[model samples]
Target: MVLGRGNFSRSVAFRWIVSYAVILLIPVALSVIVYSQTREIVEYEIKRASVAMLKQVKYIVDGELRQTENLAAQLTVHPDVRHFLDLKAETGASAYHIYRTEQQLKKMLAANDFLKDIYIYSNALDSVLSGETYASARMFYEMKNQTGTFAYEDWRELMIADHAGQYVQLPVKNKEKKENTPSYIRSFPAQAGSGAAGTLLIPLNAEKIKTMLENIDWVKKGQVFIVDPNGQILFQNSENVEALSATYRKWIGRGTSTFTDTFQGKKSMITIESSDTSGWSYVSVFPVDVFWERARAVRTLNVLGLALCIGIGGLLIYYFARKNYDPVKELVNVFSLRQRQGTSRDLDEYTYIRRNVLETIRERDDMKNRHVRQLRVLQSYYLSRLMKGQTDRNVPLAEAAMTHHLSWTSDRFAVLLFYIDSDEGGTTDLPLSQFIVSNIVKDSVEGRHAIDFTDVDGTLGAVVNVAPGRADCWKDEIEDALAQAYEFITARYKLRFTTVGSDLQTGLDGVHQAFLQALEAQEYRMVLGEDALIWYGNVKPSEGSYFFTVNDEMILLNLLKADEFEKAKGMIDQIVQRAFQRQTPLEMAKCVLLDVATTLIKSIPGPEQAGVAWEEWRPLKRLLSCATKAEFHQELHDIFDKVCGVLRSRQTAHAGAGIGDQVAEFVKENYRDPNLSVSMIGDRFRLTPQYVSRLFREQIGQGLHDFISQTRVEAAKALLQTGASIDDTAARVGFASGHAFIRVFKKYVGITPGKYKALQ
Candidate 1:
């Protein structure tokens, strides 16, 4: 778990997420700090702005009130107003004075919007005049019906009598929808002892003032309302006017106050400023969020913006991280050629990758060395076969060289032969002696490029490359190198060496002839009073007129397979004896006998059939160890006896039990016939089809049908190697059609017949 976590933590995605998250978090942190720090500053700024607006409204009210008061003063001092007040009797002159004073009042009221109406009354004349009408009685409107500017009681005290020292009024309840206008009334000219003539009264247009306040859009969005000291709403463009006025009045104690109040979770800033001239207060309460609603909007935008950034950044990081890791994934796939196993969970990626890299490098090196060694072995074997006149017609020498990556630096060649003659204290083992002499000869002839082989018994041979037109130039140097080899062998192994250099030859056939000629010269080399040959043919010394043909080998193997031990023994004896008859230089004689021994050993059915493994009999090694001709012949006799004895035992064991052995051989012989089936075999063997199928399965370890198909497929493979056409091969191998041949061949060989032929 710890390792898994460590690998995860080190991953590119994890690091990318961390990096991008840190970048995105910077804005989030800054927004939080900025939002937290700006609350008070916003409230203070809003309070100042609202207060300034309130002061401006207060000034407008005061100016209007001052203008009305100036008009009232002008009315008191006017000559026409004095003339009308001085008269007491009703006459034309009094009527003329009344008309003049009424004209003055109408003109004054027309010039100012703040004045609703201007009225003057005198008790001596028992009349009242206003902009709209003239009243003959001192109090034109009755007290019970009075509702325009004042009550009758207030009219009696101020206009009819001089009783005013201080007057205070509150908003009066009215039956009409429009609020009642307040009037500024004052008794005039009574201070100069002229007696109280009349009073000038001016009513204010409260709706006009309210309309002016409504035009301000900024304050209208929140709480902007006018309130008197009694907490009554006067002019407002907002909802819940009474409640909001009361809320502000409850917190405000004096002319102006800036304070904070919170209800529920919503906190607000209340700014209230009282107007001295109007005896009213302008109040506005703003929610804290509203005070900085712009800042709030900015904060909201930042949050949404941050969320979008995080989303985009996450995608970008994932894309870039996966793109970066793609190469690593490819490397993993390359190294892990098979599917991933559960065992890999114990290792981290880096460690697993490192191990796979090292293992792959080692495997590549091993395969390269093994391939080079296999190619060298093939080249050496091919050259040896060519020397003994066993070259394949299908495989040209140039093609073989190209296929094996062999480079031939020279066109000329010659055979250099070394004979290992065993001393009294030297080794008698044929293979060991050949091996030692081969290594010694290769090392001593250091500068020359040679293809060396230790195939024949007791002889080490090399086909050394010779420069063209300088074939004789190599003889003296080769003799000197042979002297060195002879010295080295005598000192180390108690062995004597003899050398023979064949005449220089040209081309590939010339090289093969050179080796044969060198074999021919070995006798002369020994004849020159040199060391005796340690090993010759099993029967005798070489007599050149000897050969073992393919017919000779097939008959020998068939005899053993048929359990004809005596015939096979006779065949082996005749072949060895003929191969040794008057041997020329021990080349063909040794080559023929060894070839027959190897073929018989390879054809020993299987380990179970003969009760003989390669390790058990080791026929080739034992035969090569024979000290005399008779000993060599006895070893061959023994090997053939064991192989034939094993086949004979199986035949005898099955003879009483079943015809499995006979059935297996019959299938092998008649498999080329496409109609040959289990029923045909039963008819031929005089048995039932079911019994024949069971016997074939029990003996061959496969169904009778599959065994015949496989047998034909095997033969088809040999035919394909000899460069036959696919359709011809299918017909020759008893496959019904080309398609069936391809399908069945692929079933057995994992590739189509055409593909297999191409590979060959």
Candidate 2:
């Protein structure tokens, strides 16, 4: 058994090592190449995503700042504030009209949610009103006494002296004098370039600025601090004020606008800049650790993928080395020409041949599967085009069938839809039951017709072609064939089944219409349970309207008012049913729903109390496009409730207009005029007759005619007291004649004009 050293050197083990080394090296090199390329791509993608997010955040911050500036500009232009400033400058009035100005400022501030407070600081009067109309003067006196001998005269002197130059610097002292603050003073320039000789100081809202910064989506959380131009810590997010103050001092005097620094040993990215308007520098510190934490997960995924590739490559080398050596052993046994033995060697050879044969078969199967998939795709594309009434000139029906590997030589065809209920849910993998059903349909109609099957939305459609003229006469036979197929599938495959057959028609053009009818018949599965065959022409037209009634409208309105959206949806469904029952077309019902919704929406008040106009409700149409029927109903209810609220507000305003009192005064003054009427009174007041009528009806519960006649008749009775003739009295109080006046008098006073005069 001893072999030479040279022969052993050329043995299978040596070759195996060479093969393993080559095989292993290939994947190692590939893994390194993949890792390097992937790392670069990941880094670039992260940087790109981060830059995009930062730009979005910057845009949001800039928008908010611009809004704040615009608001300030608006406040500066206020007429009341302007008048107060002017009055204070001319009269040096500390107390005069200060209460009125403060009240106006308070109301203005209260209207906006963003405003914390608004104050008018009068440089001339040397007084401050913190948007309060009625704070006691005694409190101000006490504050002045407590703040180290402060007085209005000292403040006035400071303002006048400050405005005498281009710029002024003064100490800002709080009312409690806990800390001294710096104030940069500048003269308020007049609108026409003429200088207004008054000092102005705007105290920045540090908290509000911090809030604006925090609202930025990309601003990293935790310990956000801002610094003013003079290196003061104006705001801090952290509760530990002392730590925040310490952190601010370390970077406050730094000349750089942006730089990275460490806070409590954690790396932070800080951005600092002076505001263009206030010259206040804002610093934002975002910790790098937070950013790195997000990157960690991505890094782990990349590393794991690389490691997996390397491990698989190593396993492949080990597998190849072990398997390749076994072939060498078999070769040695064959060369030796050993004595007769068991069939082990033969079995190994047979196994190898079988494996090779199976691999070849598998490759062929894969090719066939790919070909079938391509055919299905073409069929689906053509079917969609056919349904939409489009034709392809390049591919005729016969050529299309050939291209998709389908048989189309039959003279006539009928499309059959087979619905199978299986355990599999959703549009993922097709179920085995579907394949069985297809086979059953093929078997049942064997030799009688040629059939092609396709899957659509979890159901199988079989296009069966029979001889021309045979389909119409054999329609019952065609249905029986499909029914038998369906029953067999349900029993054999243990699956529920539904079959819908189209009318017997010829060619692909007929197939489209047949497919449509087949689909329509399938809808009957809702009423008739599975395992049944439905013919196209046998299906009836769906009865009833798809809309609700007036009672449903009331129910929906009440539900919406109470904010019960779920119950409102149920009622909307009922309404849809009732509408369908009333023969209301689907399109008309939808339009009615849209109108109800839009009317409700238009009734809502505008965001700024400007009141919503009909044009603003136009957006409701776009909202309607995406809304479901139930959702549309709820939206309509919401709009109506808002409109009702606006109406209530308007009604209250009208009632408070003193319409009843005004009408009484008007009637009293005009009662003796011959031509006086409600219409004349309405014209005098510049009001519509209908509006006046409504007012009278609501307030007095009487028509305008009744009120006018009562007043005129009473006036006639009073004139009679002066011993005037009935005709003269009637003529004086807006009556045409004694007889006409007598008729009205009797109607009202239960007596004729002369009788009323006799009673007097």
Candidate 3:
């Protein structure tokens, strides 16, 4: 049945469903057909490519095997090698000479990249020469003592057992031989007058051969193995290959031609067969999936291409349907004009505002320019007073301003300067509108009073010279009035404010000093809050010492002892906050804290126990560079915690070595000597006697002499080696007299010296 558009259109839902199903099925059916054909082509191509690559690999591998065989053959014919074997046959030859010859062979083998190991076996000589000679005679004797019959099978068995088939054996002979016949195993009898008499068995370098195989570019990424004619794998790269399988073992002996076989338990498409020249079979494995993977990619591409074509056809139909409609052009033209007009209006308003603001600012700036020279004079006078250490007092503003030819005799005022933190966005190029605001506030305040206000430095400050007695009264009134004005101004125009109130001062002399005090007061706001009004009188003089409470000290001590860095940091922050509240000089406070921390770290344990080298500890210079007190405290806390952690670990590791115990043991063992001293004990332990003596005195609460003397007198009575009278024994045990020893002995031993000796 043919489905017409009119009939399908009438039933829209059914029509779309059927159309979509047909559209989807068309690509799917075509994809199935194309996938089958393309898969076949890709599989054929992959197989062809793999075969070509295997051929190339075989060519390279075969060439390497031939070269190795040639090298082995040369060793058999070498005159030095032949002479060594002949000498080895005689029992009179020294082993050292044979060892020297082996070393020479090793050097030659090392120079050749293709040789893994080279060994010569002489049946008549009854000796085997490995590539390298042993330096020790005992080692040489052990190598030369191996006993076995001169047969290739013995060599093969030894190699296979030793290395587990990671090595290949190559036996090169001038003639072929029958199995089980020793006569056929004989070497090429010294040609006429020549003297070569040994068969050489060399172990092939499997990795080198594999590398050569890899250079072929088509060998695929897997193992290439070589096997002997005895159905044994002579060499393999991986241990995963099952050596017990008869089929795997038989593949090696299957003649000198290429064919496919499974290897290493995988269904590998391996090219296996023997080399006609070497009789060693090599297997180059090209996995089956290498071909199948190519087929999969081709199938995917064919389906994707068919779908792309269908999608393009649908897009073309949509494009033609849209082209038949109209009126997008006219609407676009109308909107374009409106966008242009809006842009022009924006530019016009921006330019007009910018011009007006710039012109008004310039006029205000020009009028304020007359005060710049006066401000410079005022700055010089203030700086002079600062240099002379009169910072707390004020510079007289009227006297300084009059010196620069400005009349301020009738004006009465107070100076106020405001600072605003820049926006959270970042520093913008807004040239000090806060300065303009300060001027506006100053003008408003002056307008309320009969006073004159002058800009100090561009937006940095303003100077107001008020009447002498009125300075203190107007300071508060003006500050409160201006603060309200500032709050209004900043709210009206988005900005931030920080105000510094100068101390009361008169005229031009104190004006400059007052301006400086105002500047100093602003610095206090960092520790104080934002938008803060800091006054000169409110600034406390720093005592230069932080009063940490007993609890705080214990917290710090526990942090250091337990190696808790975060807790230490928090404690330090609290300390710094208290210190800053007291107005400690930031630098001096930082130095004091760092010094305390360094002392605490050093006092934790000996440097070795601490595990921190003296050089690793943070330097005082680095601590001092911290701009804020809290930062310095944190750095100190971190260093102390690290030092303590190292100390705790070291203490845990060497809990046994207590100096007090060591001293007790020393005194107990050596108390018989009257001349014994702390110096002798110190030398034995590699410590200064002064240090040891101090430790002993502290722990025992007595001098080392009193302890040693008391113990020695008691030991003397027990010593039969001092076969003398009790008085002589007492004298020998560091006593002035026998009576004194008897007195001390009775005190410690609960008996007189003579009676103690009689009991012994």
Candidate 4:
């Protein structure tokens, strides 16, 4: 009977424990799942809201950029602007012209409060005229010295970087006023001619950018920055600008992207938006915890409830087991003693429950660890895609990263690169060498720096997550770590590794840009040599003047005239090499080479030998469509070789025809039409105007002008004899004005047009 009662109590205890566990776990699990979903929803909504606000900010910033571009375009077409830029006179007219042009520019400045000042850079005058003040020659030169020719060269680079894009230079302190001015530059004439007209600079109001960014309260809670195509931080409205800018370097070309990552040891979210016009990116950063703080309370309550349920369930199981097992007490004690011999038997009844609980916790933790590992792998792949500028479906990527437990939304990033020199000659095994390098770098920077190193081919690329307030010394820290790595690798393997790193960027979007910049810095290894940590700040844009000088043409002509074909070829190569070295616009380089070709043609025996025919050459035609420096250089060589062959054979004899007679015949046949000028004649005959005029006068014993005038008067006299009106005669004979025609007719015939007509 006692045994039967023990069995009944044992059954009751087992049922109660199972029932209580079911009652407790259901609510806790549901709460956990619900909380996780809620947190995700909240983050998604915040990202959407932030993106919408960023687009609005982008709209405002892009609108301002467009307005500035339109203003520049309008100024390019302004009558006074055209007149001032196209000025050819070097004497008395420039002062009045400069004054008038300045007045017009000043009026433009007055019309727009955003325009602080204007600079008109006249390449023809070799002067940069100011609209803000009445600048004399001395003042202009002084200003040029202060501003530097590098500024002008940079503008040219800007034009080349994007033909349709306007350039906005970073903030600079105004010399006259103790305030910052951000210069907006746009060159006149979208395409350059033989000579450039000038560049126009409008210093915009920087405060406007600040105001627009300030209105983005969500992003501004962390920081906001505008980055240009060249990776320049144009404007920022944050106390930690250095930190923010460092982060922005990573988001350079990211059109639209968002991710959650850590900043300053605190979790954060970052969003980026790019402008269609200027290619400037707008970046917004916000703390992550701020968006999910409410979910923490729900999780805490669920945890407490789950612990209470387990505690209550365990007590009931113990109570019922003791009450039900009274009859089987001896049997239970024997089993307990045997179990104690094998394991810990001091707390026998509850041991089974404890073992089961421990098993459940271990399984949960194991699953979590696996998920985190999977998330890291996904994050690595996403980072690669981001660096490659493939964030078109960024929302999905972010979701995948979040699900895997990887934070895709980092507010700041830095790319660290390790380039193993091909000629270092330490190891033939590339993978092993790369692995060793990565390990060394990782070991040196693992805990203190949050960075991921990936093998990008032979180069080991490290994409670092920059903590906030760390921008100032990030470079120093990176350099120090790299130095240590470098020493460690060299001492162990004797392999030389060159390290390069980009500036701190605002988001993962900048990772690709930073990598590119780091690569660019690596290229400078040709100039800077090896074993040095080359930073983005060390590599500068080419600042040399890109113009082909008169002396360069003279040297080429002298070589061609001397029939030194090899020397001429070398000279051609030099010209190409120098142009590319200076980073000259390919268009400008083409113009220079064509100019050289023209010089070669003119330097030949006579005009007809090289005239009209030169323009129709197949090589010249091919030159017009050539896209690269190599193709252009080859075309130049082909032209040079053909010219050299013609010189060698003396085949350019032109059938013994004299150029002066040809010019006379041409003028006699075409003089009746208007638009006839010395310059036009020179173009038709492939000769300089001065050269053509002097040759014609030498052959005809009078100036080409006198001969053309005499021919026109003779034609007008015949027309008058036919009873045509004075205006009709003037129009027929290519005279622009009837009064001028009448005067010329009277001067030649020694009478008025009517009297001359009656005599005829």
User: Judged by lDDT relative to the true structure, which candidate is superior, 2 or 3?
Assistant: 2
| lDDT for each candidate structure | 0.68, 0.59, 0.57, 0.68
| Cα displacement (Å) at residue 220, model 2 | 7.2
Write down the RMSD of candidate 2 (Cα, Å): 23.4
- Assess the local accuracy of residue 324 in candidate 1 as a C-alpha lDDT between 0 and 100: 74
* Comparing 1 and 2 on lDDT, the stronger one: 1
Runs in model 3 lying further than 4 Å from the true structure? 1-34, 49-53, 85-100, 122-125, 134-188, 191-196, 206-224, 248-268, 284-287, 310-760
Clashes of 2: 15
Q: On TM-score, who's better, 1 or 2? A: 1
Residues 106-175, model 2: lDDT tens digits: 6756655344444445544444555743233334334432245555556555544534222122333454
Weakest 10 consecutive residues, lDDT, candidate 1? 532-541
Taking the tens digit of each residue's C-alpha lDDT, what string does model 3 give over 1-760?
1225554443333434456557766877877787768756754665566556655655765676666656655665677676766663346556776777688788877877766556665544555667764223233223432233335445534422322112233343313421111111124345446444555555555566556655656544566566666656655555565663676565555554444556655555655655665565666566666667767777778778877867775675455434532243233334444342233322222243344457669989987887786675665455444323455534354554455454455334345566655545533334556445655675666644443333444334555655445654776667766777677666665666677777766444455667667777766666565666777776746555445445556666666654455666676666556555535654555545664565556546674534453556644656666665446656766666666677556544653346767787888886656556888887776555665676677766777767787678556765634557877777666666778677877887787767666666
**With candidate 4 superimposed using the best TM-score fit, by how many Å does residue 134's alpha carbon deviate from the native?**
3.4
For model 2, what is the C-alpha lDDT against the true structure? 0.59
Position 576, candidate 4: lDDT: 70
Best by lDDT: 4
How high is each candidate's TM-score? 0.33, 0.31, 0.29, 0.33
Over 1-760, each residue of candidate 1 has an lDDT whose tens digit, in order, gives 1235556876545666678778877877886687676766676687787777777777777788778777777777788887777776555346676777788888887899876667677766666777767776533654212656666665557566652221224233334343445567677665346567666666666667877777764567566666666676656765454464344457546568877786334676677777666566777766767667676776788678768877887788677777776676666656567534553655544566787667769989999999888876886676677666677645654575576565555667777666657889999887788778778877876566544553643356677775445455676666666778778888899888666666777666776787777776555453232542211222224434436777777887776655556677788888766654433444565667777887677566675634473667877788776544456677787877677666656654654344677777888998888888888997797555765677677766789888888889999999999999889999998878889888999999999988888887
